[model samples]
Target: MPDTGRTMYARVVEHTCDDCVPVSYELCAAGGLMFIRWTDRTGGGKPVVRETERLISSRAREMWRDLLLGLVR
Candidate 1:
């Protein structure tokens, strides 16, 4: 795994098979959204994963709940 500047990304890595390429791994940064990756049945192919944005939280639950109720109406 390698460290990038702000965002964190992982490379697809293959093992045991000569055709597979070794991927570079990385971890998500602090307070950053995490990503996922996977492979298909094909012997050789690009990895698939999902993109995500940062998460936000509220300091008070009552404030958030009231906001949600207001929107629902």
Candidate 2:
């Protein structure tokens, strides 16, 4: 999450359970591309944030749908 270029106005398209686990995932869109963001809140310390490479909305949505269907992890 150190990337200063990350969009501050990113729109979250979908997300996993919130406040119910130590980790969460979000499908986001910004600047005409989509990507997956993951956060880990383990060890009761600073959370670790990461993201997948940005892709076209259609392709990213397909991957997001597959993730929801348990077709991929």
Candidate 3:
């Protein structure tokens, strides 16, 4: 297995609510490929949703960077 312990970048967005929910994004590399994961909680932590994608192309990596920048702004 590849070393999934390394993270290339990460971001967290906290919602302005009573619970102060947090959504997280992480970009990592494993098995010589890059992947992005998104994690969020639902129903007051009763359930969680996690989505991930493999970045197979430069265009996809660029789009991911753009999205991160947009979120920061």
Candidate achieving the largest TM-score: 2
Write model 1 residue lDDT over 1-73, tens digit each, in one string.
1123345443322112324644322222234334222223343466533322322323222333443456411
- Candidate 1 vs 3: which has more lDDT: 3
lDDT of 2 by residue, 27-73 (tens): 99999999988888996898888888889999999988888888977
**C-alpha RMSD of each candidate structure in angstroms:** 13.4, 2.2, 7.7
Q: How far is candidate 2 from the true structure (C-alpha RMSD, Å)?
A: 2.2
Residue-level lDDT of model 3, residues 1-73, one tens digit each, is 2324455443422212324556555554444555555545655654353434555546446655765777531
- Taken over the whole model, the C-alpha lDDT of each candidate is 0.31, 0.85, 0.49
State which candidate, 1 or 2, has the greater TM-score: 2
State the displacement of the C-alpha of residue 36, model 1, in Å, after optimal TM-score superposition: 6.6
Which portions of model 3 miss their true places by more than 4 Å? 1-21, 57-60, 71-73
- Give the candidate order by descending lDDT: 2, 3, 1
Off-target runs (Cα >4 Å) in candidate 1 are 1-6, 9-44, 57-73
Clashes (backbone N, CA, C under 3 Å), per candidate, total 2, 0, 0
Top candidate on lDDT is 2
Between candidates 2 and 3, name the one with more favorable TM-score: 2
